[model samples]
Target chain A: METLDGYLDMDLLRFTTAGSVDDGKSTLIGRLMFDTKTIFEDQLESIERTSRQRGDENVNLALLTDGLRSEREQGITIDVAYRYFATPKRKFIIADTPGHIQYTRNMVTGASTANLAIILVDARKGVIEQTCRHSFIASLLRIEHVVLCVNKMDLVDYAQERFEEIVAAFKAFATRLQIKEITFVPISALHGDNVVNRSANMPWYEGPSLLYHLENVYIGPDSNHVDARFPVQWVIRPHSREHHDYRGYAGRVHGGVFRAGDEVVVLPSGFTTRIRSVERFEGPVEEAFSPMSVVIRLEDDIDVSRGDMIAKPNNQPRVEQELDAMFCWFSPERPLEPGRKYLLRHTTRSVRALVREVRYKVDINTLHKEEGDVQLGLNDIGRIHVRTAEPLLYDSYRRNRLTGGFVLVDEGTNRTVGAGMIR
Target chain B: MTQSYQLSHLDQLESEGIFVLRETAAQFERPCILFSGGKDSIVVARLAQKAFWPARPPLTFLHVDTGHNFPETIEFRDRFLGDLGAQLQVALVQDSIDRGRVVEEKGPNASRNGLQTVTLLDALEEGRFDAAVGGARRDEEKARAKERFFSHRDEFGQWDPKNQRPELWNLFNGRKQTGEHFRVFPLSNWTEMDVWQYILREEIPIPALYFAHEREVIEREGVLLAVTEFLTLREEERTERRTVRFRTVGDATCTGAVESAASTLEAVIEEVASARQTERGGRADDRRSEAAMEDRKRQGYF
Candidate 1:
C-alpha cells in the first residue's frame, strides 16, 4: 500500500493520555500537534479567533483539544477526545481521557485499544491519588508502555530531584500492578520544554524527548501473538455470478497468525477444518496475523457463523458456562447485584449471564481489597463470578486483551452496566 | 515473495474499517451505510464492497438527499451503486418540506444542511434500521472526535455525548432499546491525509469534483462556494471562474471549494499533505458556530 513515488508507510502507534482538568493533558497534546506543524492554518485561525473573543492574553492551546461546544464553553474536557499527529518517523493516535472520578469509565474506554498510556503528573502537586488512579487503570488495561510526564517543571525550577522523587513514588505503586516499562520525563507543557524538543532549562535530562521516545518505541511486541483467536464477526456469503457459494468467515485476527491450509477448530461446535485461503481485499495472502481483518475460507462447510471463535487446535481458549472476572461497574443507577441477569458480550458473542456470587470490592486510592463491600457501583472495580446460559470461549485478560475483555448490558435497560476482564 | 508480517498504515485502517462494517452487519438486524455521494462516503461504499467481497454489502445504502447536493455526486452515486447491484434508499429533504415535517430556512445563507436530519431520521424509522453507518472521521471536527464507533441514539434520535456507552477495543456494544438506533462510524480514526493516501494506493475512483478545475465560484465569508443551481449569490457576491476543488461534498450551498491545481489522485494527495486548513474548516455549515456540527448530530444529522 505504497505510492510509486516512494512514499514511506509509517507504523501506527495508538496511545492514551490521562490528566485531570488543567493538568496539561490537552496542553501537551496541543503542543505535540503545534510543534509537529500538523495544525492547519484555518483551524489555528478559528482557535485564535475564539481565543481573542474569550479575551485570553496568549492564544489558548487547550482550545485546540476541547472541541465540543459544551467542553469549550466550560473550558474543560468531558469525554474521551481523540487527536492525531505524525512525525517523519511514526504516526500517532492520542486518546485523550479526562481525569475525573466519574470519568474512570472513559479512561478505560480510551486505554482499551492503546499500546501505550501517558499519565501526566503535575510537578507542583507531586504524586497524588489521581496519579495512582491513572497508573492503576493503565496497568489494569494492560498498557505495556507508561510515560510519567512530570509537567510544569518551570514552576519547580526544572529540578531533577523533584522528577526522581515522583518517579520513585510511581514505581513503588506500580510494583503492586503489572507494568512492563516506565519512562520519566520533566516537561513544561505550557512553555514547550522536553515535549517535542529538548529544553535548555533542564540541561541534566539526557533521555529522549517525548516525541522522540514515542516515535522510536517498539510497539510490535505489544499484542499477544502466541494465541490464535478469530472471533467470527460476519459470515460473508456472496452468492454471486462469478464467485458463487463464497462462504468466508470475516473477522479481525485478534491474536497469533493464520495461514492457508492451517488446521483450525471452530469453537462451541467442536468442528475442525483447514483454511482454504486467507483472503484480503488486495488478494489471497500466504498468511495473516493479528489485527488484520481478512476473510478466512474453510476447506469444509462446517456450519460456522457469527459469535463463533476460530482457533488453532493446539492452543485453544477455555470454554465453559461458569466464569470469573474482575468487573468494573459503569452505571450510576444500579449496583452489581448477584441475582441480576446481564447480556455478557464477549468479542462477537453475547449471552445471558447471571451473577452467581459477589466478590470483594477494591479501594483504588489505598490499593486495598475491601472484603465487606461486595457491592460494585459506578467506577467500582471488584472480582465477581458469573454463569452464562451459553458457553463462552475466552482467555485470561492478562494473556490477551481483545478476547478476554467484555461488557455487561442490563437485559431490560440495554445500558452497558459493567466492563469485565476474564480471569 | 514472502508476505511481510507488518501492515501498512492504509492496510491497518482498511482492516479496522472492514471489521467495523462486519460487526454492524452481525450485531444489528437492519443497518444501512449513510451515503452522501461525497468522497468520504464513496470510500465507505468501496470499503463496504470489499468487506463482503464476492457478495454485495448485504446492506442497503441510505442516501439522505438534501435536494441541494451536487448533481455530479448524485450521478456518481447512481453509477457506483448500479455497478455493485446494491439497493439504494433515498431520503429526500424536499419530501420533508412538502409534508410540512421540516421548514426550509429563509435567507441568503439558507441551506438545507441542517434540515437533512429530519429526513434522515424519518428514513431510519421507516426502514427500521438499527444502525446508520457513516464516514465521519474524528479529525474532521471536535465533537465528532469524541464520538464512539457505536454511538447510541435515544428514541428521539438524539445523541447524548455525555451518556455514551464505553466502546472498548474492537468489541462494539450495539445493543439498544426498541426505538433507539446507533450511528456507527468506521473511519473515526482516519485523518484526511490517510483517506487521500488510501484512495491513491487503492486507485479507487473518486468524483472529479475532488480535483481542481475551472469552476464558477463566489467567495463568501472567507470561503469559496461553487455556483450550483441551489446557490443564490448575495448582492455583494459575484461568481468568477477559479481553479478550485472541494475538500468535501455536501449540500452545494454549504460545502466550499479550495483553491488548488490538483487534477489526479496523486496530485490531490500531495495537495492534501501540504494543505493549511482542514477539509471542514472551509465548510459553511460547520462554520455556523463552534458547535454547529455537534448540535446537528444531537438531532440525528449525518
Candidate 2:
C-alpha cells in the first residue's frame, strides 16, 4: 500500500540472501540500508562511536545489521536475522539466513514467504555446495524470482565468462527443481560493485544493477490469483450493535478473487453459501482478493470456523486420504519414523496423520534424489507417504503456496517438526 | 467501478502480524502473548485472535503486572479477554519483590518498572514458555531498531544481541539447543505512523490516555507527568493543569505525555503524520542512554 503524499508506504519486500559464510550477506544488507539513508541518525552515530572504539579505520557495514552480541563476536550468522529498509521505489525486508549445513532449516523458514531470493556466490569460488543448498530450498519454497549475485567480481577482474559459468551452473541445478525466473548479476558487495548503482568495471554486462532488479521485479502476481481459497479464521458477531444479525467469517484470502454474491463451497462439509458481504473496517467492498484480510458474510450461516476452507465449487482441491509429499525435518532429536502420528495442519484444516512410507532423501550438491533409504534427520529433505485421519484439499506446491503447503506439529512436544509441500 | 487490489494500511498490518503470530505458534514449543492492555499489546492480542480462527488462540495471555497501572487498562484487559474467551495469566512484580527475588526501589520516585524482569523471567520459567511475543516496534527506540524479529535469550534470561542468529527471508530460526527463550516480535515492521494509521482504519479500542484530556501534571525532565496516586510533586517541582495525551504507557513514574488536541483517531493519525519527533521522544526511561533498550532487553525486559 503506497501513501498519498509520494513517500513510500514501506511496501515491504521479503527476500532471502544466501551464500557461503564469507560472501558478505550481512555486509550487502548493511550497505543497502546505509546507502539508502534508512539507518537512523542515532544508529549511525553509535556505529561510528563503536567503530572508533574498536580502533577500525573505517565504519564496518557488517556491524550495522548484525545485532546479536555473539554473532558479532564470532563473525558468523547462526540464526535467521530479519532487517527492514525502504527506498522511495519500495520497502524491503531482508531475511539474512545462515549458510552452514546445520542451519538449513533456517533457510527454509526464511524462503517460505519470500517473493524473491538473492543467492550470493563468490566469483572466485564459483558455485559451491552451500550455493546449491540455498537455491534448492528457495525453489522448494516456491520463491518466484532468483537473483544470482556474483559477489567479489573485483577479485575475478570482472570477467564476463566467470559470471556465465556461475549462472550456467546455477541454472543446471535449478532445472532439477521448479524455478520460474533467474537473473545473473556480477557484483562485489564488499567493494560496492553493481549493488546500488551500475558497476563501471563490468563493461560487457548490460543489465540493471542489484537494487534496480529488486525495485522493478514483477511481484504483483507473486501470490496465487487463480484458485479461490478463504479459510475462516473467526466468526465475528459483535453483539449489541446496529446490525445484530451480522455473522461474518473473518479470514485473509489465500488464493483467487472473491466477489460479493459469489457462491462458495465450505470444505470438510460440502455446504454451499452465497457471499452476503465482504467487509473491512471501511465497510462493505465490491470484491476481495488474495492477501486481503476481510470479514466475509454469507447468506446462510454455515458451520465455518478456523480450519474450514471456502473455495469455488468447480475448481475444488482433491479430497484425498493419502498424501504424497516432500517434507523437511526441522528437529534434530527426532527422526522421521514410519507409523508415527503427527498433527498435520494443512491450510486451515488440522488432522491426524501417520507416516505411511519414506520415499527418498534429496542430495542438494549433486541434484540427485536418493530412493530406498528412509531415515530423515535434522535439515533432511525427503519424500514420504502420509495418511490423514480426514481427507485434505490440496494443490501442487507450484500451483499455489498458501493451499499447497502444511506444517506438521509434534503432538507431545508441540514443535513444528516438519514442513511439507504436496507433490 | 471494480478495483483489482487496494490493501488498507490497517488490513495489511493485521495480515502481516497474523502471519507472524501463526509462524511463532507453528515454530515454538510454548509461546505466549505479553498483554499490557496498551495500544501496542492490544493490537498484538487482536492479531493473535485473527491468527487462529475456529479455535481460540492456541496460546495464553501473559501479563506482567507492576501493581501500578491505570484501572482503565486493567478493566479493558479483562473485558477484551472475556469477549474472546481467552485465558489470562498474571505475573506480579510485587510478588517477586515480596519473595525476595527482586528488591523494590526505596525512593519517592521509585517505580517497580525495572524490577519487572525478575517476575517476567520467573513466569516464563514457571510456565515453561520458550517464546514470548512482545509489542515492541522498531521505531520506539534506536536499540529496538537493531533487534531481530526473533531475539534469542540465554538460560539466564539475558539477551545477547551480539550473538543473534542470522534471519534471512520469511524463514525464522526457531531452533533452541536447550533452556533458551525467544522474544518474537510480529510488529517489528510497523512504524509509529503505521500504527496510528492502522488504529484509525481498524478503529481499535485504546486507553483514554492516548486522547487529550484535562489532567493535573508536574513538570520534570522537560515532560508533563500526569499526577496520579503513584506520582507526587517533589518539593522543587510545581504542578499545573494541562490538556495532554500520552504516546506510550509504562510505569506512571517514567511515562509522560505531550500537549495536544487530537482527541479522535483520525486526528491522532494526522498528528503522528505531521510530527517530526519519534514516538519514544516522550518516554523518559529510553532517554536515559543510547543503549537503554538494549540493556533492558538483556535483563529480560520487554
Colliding pairs, model 1: none
Q: DockQ for each of the predicted structures, in order?
A: 0.72, 0.18
Report the number of the highest-TM-score candidate. 1
Best by DockQ: 1
Quote the positional error of residue B28 for candidate 2 in Å.
14
Looking at model 2, residue B201 earns an lDDT score of 54
Model 1 regions lying over 4 Å from their true place:
A1-8, B1-4
Q: Which ten residues in a row have the lowest lDDT in candidate 2 chain A?
A: A1-10
Looking at candidate 2, what is the lDDT of residue B34?
Answer: 94
lDDT of 2: 0.78
Chain A superposition TM-score, candidate 2? 0.94
Candidate 1 lDDT tens digits, B202-292 = 7777788898899999999889998988888789899999999988988898898999998887788878777878888888988887678
Model 2 per-residue lDDT tens digits across residues A1-423 = 235334324355779887556787877887887777666555676679888988878787777776555555676766666666666666676777877888787788778878899988888998888888888888888897899888889998899998999888878777776778999999888778889999889979999999999988877655677888887755666463465666777777888889899998988698998888787655677888878777788889768876678888887877788988878888767898888998887765678999988889987666688888668898899898899998887887778887778778777654577788888
